[model samples]
Target: MSAIMKKAWGYRYWVLVILWLVYIINYFDRMAVLTFLPFIQKDLHLTPVEVGQLASVFFFAYAAAQISAGFLADKIGSKRVMYIAITVFTFVTALTGVVKNFGQFIALRIGLGLGEGHHFAPAIRAINNWFPFKERGRAVSFFATSWAVAPAIVPVIVTSISVSFFGGAWRPVFYVLAIPGAIGIFLLWRFISDSPKEMIAKGKLSKDQDIEEENVAPKKLSKEEKRKAYGVFLKDANFYVFTLCLFCQLAVYWGTSTWLTSFLVTQHGLNIKEMGFFASAPYIVAFFAMMLGGWLMDNVVHRMKPVALIGYIGSIPVLWMLGSVEKGNTGLLLTLLLLVGFFVNLNFGSIYAYLPKRYPKEIVGSATGLANGIGQLGSFISPLIAGYLVTVGANGSQDFSRVFIFFAIVSAVAALCAVILKEKKVTKVPANTIGSEKSVS
Candidate 1:
């Protein structure tokens, strides 16, 4: 098994593949609602505010679950936490097909958020566990592409499925989407371990590198241990700034993603089918944006702030210009969407690359969880505020100008936060250096 595994692909690459696929499933299920927002809104007689509530509520639940989930990942093992997450979220997704009212939809959306929120920090923990310093940047960056990929293709795939197979019903699309998630569960069990030491001890892999891993078993933590873990990151002043920056970035991200489809349809006057392809245009550029951001962080900048700052600053003008676009100008609209996609997405790889370098790997899950969890507050409010700003006229048209302005404001905030961040320097150790700090910058 080991020889065949090594011959086909290294175990680390296999882990990346499995995690990436699972993340794609995670996002596909999450994005299905947004892709068909107009249908869901129409069917439920939902107002603009309520349409925004569905998206914001999910982030609220997702954010609320993150800290506990991060702590759980540190305690129980990333793989175990992931197993629970995949099962719960997938089940919740299937149940979404049958909701009959706003209350039921909110209940199930909360379920989906709680289930999926646990997966991310654990996945970050796993990447740090498996990859060495130099290569970790590229590894995490590639894994992050699942975000762009799932949303990029989901609009086309889900839209086509709804229009063709289910006769344009949104609910059935959720049911079809749920089936593929089980594959992620099975893959995680077959191929993943919590750490390299565990993999080596189990005879699934050989000790191929100079990594000296701690043989920490997943077990119940003492109250003091938990406190110390939480306290360590809590005391770090930089963590607050980092979290704030993440907050702004996610605010822009979720706000744009959650509302972009509706904006294209209602304001720009595109049919749903045309909206799907146009909706996907920005994210296609985003896939390359993340890749290039990762490459630049690893090879060129060697610092995360510059990359993040550039992304935030570069996106501001693009976002502001989106308000100037007139309906039926698909050419200019596509150009602006593509630009906004590139700029907002460019910093994720750089931000992700910064985490393992900034904190001890032992506490990375907690650090990441808290930061991202707080960041989700931004995620929650952006959509809700956008929904509030979305003025629906008596004639059934939407004015989305304020939403674009809001995104630009947040992008500016993120750039300012990036400017205040201090660069970190990792001490280079010999290949045999183990159990201390890993390379980040």
Candidate 2:
């Protein structure tokens, strides 16, 4: 094996493993609320619209916080920012149990969003620092697997916890979940260093140490110049197009996943437990699809380019078919939903892999944060909109048919936008250009 490959399979592999676990917890905490939504709704005596709004408040804060977090991650180091963010998130997640009213609930959800929002931009930056460009797709995808794993495992855990410890009460479920996060914070403090300089100096040096230090050493940029550069990134056509693509994708995926369990229970007449099992089926399929997709994107396709478009366009018809399925067709519904999960998550690693390839390292976190912030707004809005549609249906009916059709249309639009995404061959970072930490500046 090559030297890098040999190293990758050793201690560096452990680094990747740790990063993935951190992300798993990150996603677990973020999504644990969703799995418990039904219980929360019932306990609070909330209507469908209120439930949706509560769910959305987290995303609203998450989306807004990502922008500033991106900039802050660069100003400080990703490691420190992540350490603080994770601790804050864990505490807030635990505190969610204590909420007595809608206002308190809303405040806690917003805090959850803001705390969790910092994880992605910084995590991606750390991945770029740890792995070389050639291996990034697979490396990053390995981390991105948290999305699939979260839905697959977290719901099951939350269900068990609710049944066993919380006596089916959603409030104490949050408290129990927060205990491990305390340990997670300590591990982050002990192991994760911002860059290789810290890594090597801390006696953890390995190969490529020089390259990592070169990447992290501070540079200087004037305030006015930083503003001009941020302006350039914001005004770029390709950036906006990519943002819209993610927006559509998140809208469709979140809309479907957020409501899938409820849909199965209400429309198909399945019990809550059955709905949980059905909801988990897609994430199971997604796990294999993501692993295989990452391998294919890296080992075979190697274009590292437009393969994301294929994943997007291919999902349109699948989602359409999923929407068109009749309520009684359990076999067909499960099959198609599985495929939807696979294809939707298939492109996830590819989309994130595109950012570090296209942007200069200096601004990659900001650019990623910008894209994620814009895309995550869809996460904020999709649930709210879907709930409104269902609530406003004839005679308080919760028919998700129209919502499904809208999601299908959005998927197609995303495919069209993905087709227009520019693929730059190289990133040009001018030598000796010093600027402020551009986390948000």
Candidate 3:
């Protein structure tokens, strides 16, 4: 590669790229179930509520695991925690292909959740370790694209395999899905380190690079110090506000995403192929929308709240329209879903940009983990609640319109919480981490 090319794809960006790919696999495992939900529901003879439970249980387990994952990443190092998470979840994903009953299905979902839950906080911590506050908007925003792209691709990829290779078997797609996780495992082990310093030591990163945490080695915190870190964020009102905001955001994201297939296939009368195309459309738009949102956060607003507030407020009408669109109005459905994808996803760039800036680098993982964990409570509730909201028409077909209305209301709650978050600096980022970073959360 040319020097300019190498500089553009340098270790800093490569780290982000690796984490992004891993997260893509993570969503693939999570959302593949949703994509295959109608198939799974039929094959297993499952109720809509039961299908919701399968998705909900994963978040419950995922939410429960986040705090501990953060602490362990802080304590042991992100590399190891990530290694373990990847191993457990990939194994669980493959096991999913073999599930013959509901009990086994739920078990795999929880296992997937528990294993996947640990990956995010640690990956965020690793990014915080490398990028300074200024570059983080782009770095984290790009990483967040995995969330958008993976979901956009999942419906198509899984549907194609189910139809073409396996003759519509949902089970075999899990086996295919597990391949990326295996590749991610090798990538994580081979190239990634917990911090830039470790990468430098391994000679993967060139010496004398202008990177944060380039000289500071990873530290293992004592029990007393860990407690003190937790206490620091605990006292910050922004912590509570951010967590609540995440809860609301998760409701909008997971609640809608978890049930998207059913909403398209069941309510709108789209076939699996049509559902795949329509479902992929929103997330495809989200990739560009979120990228623009992140760029705006860095150069335009120079803060997260204004940008995010706009997103939260903007999503309300779109989500409501998404639900209210009558069956067979394919044109309106496409337009509304596209708008939801754009407005709803715009929150992430600013949302993720705040964490590493707001908390001490030593405890960024814990802060992120705890906030995300608490936020996932919203993730846990929305799907199951949406499941319950499924109305049976006189024709006995299920309608999921009420679920989008629920998300619309929850988006308003998120907007209110976003209002509570402060823009002023809250915690001092250690000089080694960011050369005097201000609180951005």
Better of 2 and 3 by lDDT: 3
What C-alpha lDDT does candidate 1 achieve relative to the native structure? 0.81
Runs with alpha carbons beyond 4 Å of true place in candidate 2? 1-9, 207-232, 391-397, 431-441
lDDT, residue 408, model 1: 97
TM-scores, one per candidate? 0.90, 0.89, 0.91
Clashes of each: 0, 6, 0
Ranking by lDDT: 3, 1, 2
> What does the lDDT read for residue 222 in candidate 3?
62
Give a tens-digit lDDT track for model 3, residues 174-262. Answer: 88877898899999987688876776677665655454452255465566666665666777778889989988988889887877877
lDDT of each: 0.81, 0.74, 0.82
Give Cα distance to truth, residue 200, candidate 2, Å: 0.7
TM-score of the candidate numbered 1? 0.90
TM-score, ranked from best to worst:
3, 1, 2
| Predicted structure with the largest TM-score when compared to the true one | 3
After superposition, candidate 3 runs with Cα above 4 Å error: 1-9, 213-220, 397-401, 427-441
lDDT (Cα, tens digit) per residue for candidate 1, span 1-441:
656454212667788888999999999888887777778888889986677678778999999888878878887889999999999999999998888889998999999999999899899888877776566667788888899999888777888898899888888898898778888888898889997677778877776545544323333446665565455568766679889999999999888987887799889989967987888888898889988888887788777888898899999999988966999888999999999989999988778767776665657788888888998899998887877788889998898988899899999999998999875633322233322334334
Per-residue lDDT of 1-441 in model 2, one digit per residue for the tens?
A: 345633322445566777778878877777778877767777778886677678888889999988887787767777888887888899999998877767788888899899999888988877776666667778777887888888789878887888888677788888877777877676677666665555756665555533533345334446655565555467667779888888987888788888787778777778777777788888888777777666777778764335666677778778767755777898998888888888888877777877766666556778888889989999878877776665434665467776776777887888888777766533444443322222210
